[model samples]
Target: MLLIDLDRFKPVNDLYGHAAGNAVLCAVADHLEDLLPVNGIAARLGGDEFALLVPFTGGIENLKRLAQQVITSLVAPISWNGGAVKVGATIGIALIAAESDADTVLHAADLAMYQGKREGRGTYRVFEDSMDTELRERAALEAELREAIEHGAIEPFYQPVVSLPQRDCVGLEVLARWRHPTRGLLGPDQFIPIAEETGMIADLSYHLLRQACLDARSWPSHLLLAINIAPQQFQDRDLAQRILAILAETGLSPRRLEVEITETALVQDLEAARTTLTSLQNLGVRIALDDFGTGYSSLYHLRELKFDKLKIDRSYVDTITMSEERAKLVDAIIKLGSSLGLVTTAEGIETDASVAWLSGQGCNFGQGYLFGKPMPKGEVMRMLQAGPRLEQIGISSMPESRIHAVPMEAIIHCGVGRAA
Candidate 1:
């Protein structure tokens, strides 16, 4: 028995509508039919899921090969409406036994398929007895998460985003942390995917936003509060309104709030994202594209969306000191931001060299452990009250700035910006 689940299928439906989604599904069905062995029964088990029951005389090795082939076939992009719609499949294999009931076999395969998803996309897992226990634990954790959301147990931690060269605290990025009763303190990685999968992300996000907004009430007016919006939250048509309402209730001005979104969110539904972003912008809120270099269509998104800031992903910054090519890329990104009148923030700046290089390259903002890790609300309050000073945090003085203002000469040298 093979249970297959399609990944990234919703994004296609969201971007191109249900017609494109149905077309892609039909294409997948055709591929399954072509790939199935003799006497194998291929069935559509419902939305973006399929099952294959094959009468096999072969060993487990052959089934493994067959699973890989199915994965390869299903992952190919299907052309739709003059564009390509791509989706990936995760397969779970279960061997049929005379004593096993149909329901039991299907449940085992389902658990295995979910395990494959948790590991990563486009992989296969064979049914194992241990998966059942894992599934139960996951269910219990989900229930605990739901209760925690209701009780507002999830807390926000703030990481400071400092000005380049000067290294002054300019803003704080709010991150989520869960205080689990049995598990102690849990990071977002432990429960965020579960929240997203179980459709509880919206509730959890709103809860966190409300708390963060309230926490920011004591912050200085000039200091920004940047909060990341999950990709799934973009699907909510009332997203802008809900956030605006939260701001109003908390008595925090919309101007002080920055909504950071990933490229994955933008690609999901550009029209919807544009509408929500425009609404927020009109209300004096700022929009920033987060994890900038990690996405496929950064330039396209920059052109289409009215982003106020472009955040450089940490991957580029981590290697800039060691890799000359990476340094050039970072320089180019900063130049790109400068030309577009958008502020550029570099993430994961840990060393003095990284700080010096980024500041020299004219990156406007810097974040990462070199400055400060995400701290609880109490530490954030104390830091803000104490004032923005590197000496307070025990960091040494920063090197002088190499590129200060983007003068006409520098613009000409960089091959960007118009002559003033």
Candidate 2:
């Protein structure tokens, strides 16, 4: 039995449409049949996946040759409309071992196919027992994430976004933290990719967005709540409408909410993302390009999208003090934002020296450990009630100070002054 999976198939479905996707899948089936042996049969399992079965008790060399032919024939581009649709094949082979039943053989082949995918597509793998362990671990993580979302165990930890020089907490970024029962606490780095692959990202994002909005309602209307948007989450047609609903239900003003999405999200389908942002902006919401300088088309997106903020990624910030070239790049980014009338935010400012340097550059805002790590809502409220002074970030009376928008500190306690 040979199981084949098409690579780069989703992009075709996403960029083109189901009609294009179906045409490609049908072309693959035809290619498989044309290359099949006399008694060989090919069937499409689902989506862009196909299966080929042949009764062959010959040497492994013949089976290997057949697999190579299958890949070569399937890799050719298929005509869809006036354009060409391209996808590569990843194949897995399973031979009838001594005691291997139909189900067992099929399972083995599927595991090998996935291994082929991991090794990079356009390859093939023979069945092995080791792949099962990795698959099981992935399955377990997905199960935990589903349960956590259902039980509302995922909490939003708010980190302060401090206005530079002035050091006032003008905003808080809502970060997701999973309160796993056995694992204590888990960061997004650990489970977010799994959630995205398992199709739980939309559910997870909506859950957190709603909770973050509700939590921010108690803050002063002048303060903003920023949240990250996953790349796949933008593909949803109702994304903007859903955000407006969450804002209304949480009693948070649309103007006080800032949506942060990476430049890569806009690269998928520029037109679609434009519409989503335009709709959100129509609701009086603000848009920010998060993690700048990471994606392929950052400048193009910037030119096209009317973003209100440009967040300098931490990678660039980390090298500012050490590398002269990097320092110049950082300066240019800040200046670029200023020229465009955008709020330039320096992320991951860990040291007092970086903070001091950023303030000197006339940077608009900064966020990182120097400001404060993400904290519970109760802690944030207490800090707010204490007052807007942000001396806790170790920025007490700088050598030179110039007042900016609001006289607040880098701490979450922005002296929201709306009462505890």
Candidate 3:
């Protein structure tokens, strides 16, 4: 039995669309067929994965040759939807011995395929017992995540969002942190996918929203709070109603809350997403497109949805120092957002150089490790009260600290009092 795993397939499907994705899959199947013996069977197991069963009464050399052929065949570019798409495959080989059952052989092949994925892909690996240990560890982590959420072990961390031009603390982004009683503070990488797969993201989303609102209510009235909304949360029929109720119960103004959704969410079911978003917008809440340029359909969705804000993904920002292409892309996205009358926020700003470049390029806002990592509500409040500072030496200077110099009478007249 042999299994082939395609690497980085999600980005291709995401950037080029599923029709292109299907073309790649079909090409892979054809390649496998050409290599397999007449009795061999090739099947697409779905989503960039494929399986082949060959009557392997043959030597190791023959199996290696077949793997090489399959890889070489897949190297050719595929044309779909007027675009050229390229992809590579990783092959895993497992022999069906005289004593082996079909299931056992398939299992071995599957493990070997994953081994190829782990070993940098575009290569082949034989099955080994070690892969079983890694699988079990992942399973255990997933189970623990379920228990952690049930026991209210997840906590919120706040990241400060500073205003551009003035550089004042304008808002906070609520980030989820899992604090396993036994495992200490676990990052989202440990449990987020588990939450998504198990359909627990909706509950988690509501929990985070409520917690963030409640915390924001305790802060100075001028500060706003933002929370990420998973696509699954939108699938809930009563999501808009639930958010409205939460805002009313918390006595928080809807204007102070921003819910971020990715471009993928907008594309999944455009009409339904539009209705849901319109309802939220009607309630005075702001909607921001998260990871703007990362999605293939970003421009299409931007024209259709008319979101209030466009958040540039970190992938583009992270590469600005290394690649001019990324820098130009960021520049174009900022201009695009501006032309659409949308506020643009660049995420993952990690250095003085990047911040200077983005600020010069007319980017409206930025978020990254350079400003602050996500913290608890109290820490964020303290940071906000401390005001914004310009840490970069000799690049562009920050605007004067007029944010803190606003008179107490003006604040009172604005009807926003200091936090208790």
TM-score per model over all chains: 0.87, 0.70, 0.78
Residue lDDT tens for model 3, 1-420: 778878656656766678777778887777777777878888888778788777766577777778877877787787777767778889888877799997887788887887787577888877777877877887788788777667767778765455454444455566678877778877665676568767887776666677777887777676666667776666777888888888888888877777778765665556667888899899877888888877656778877886888888888998887899999999999888888898888777778788778888888777666666666656555554554442322211223211232221111000000000
- Candidate 3 accuracy as TM-score: 0.78
Better of 2 and 3 by lDDT: 2
In Å, residue 85's CA in model 1 sits off its true spot by 3.8
* Clash pairs for candidate 1: none
The lDDT values for all models are: 0.79, 0.76, 0.70
Specify the highest-TM-score model's number: 1
What is candidate 2's CA lDDT for residue 308?
A: 87
Candidate 2: regions farther than 4 A off: 1-131, 392-420
The total number of steric clashes, by the backbone 3 Å criterion, in model 1 comes to 0
Better candidate by lDDT, 1 or 3: 1
Q: Candidate 1: lDDT of 311?
A: 84
The clash number for model 3 is 1
Question: How much does candidate 1 score in TM-score?
Answer: 0.87
| Cα shift from native, residue 199, model 1 (Å) | 2.4
Model 2 residue 279 lDDT score? 97
- Once superposed on the true structure, which residue ranges of model 3 sit more than 4 Å away at CA? 4-28, 37-39, 44-49, 55-98, 108-126, 384-420
After the best TM-score superposition of candidate 1, give how far the Cα of residue 354 lies from its true spot, in angstroms.
2.1
Per-residue lDDT of 164-264 in model 2, one digit per residue for the tens?
77666666666678888788888876778677778787788888878877777776656666567777877898889988888888887777777888766
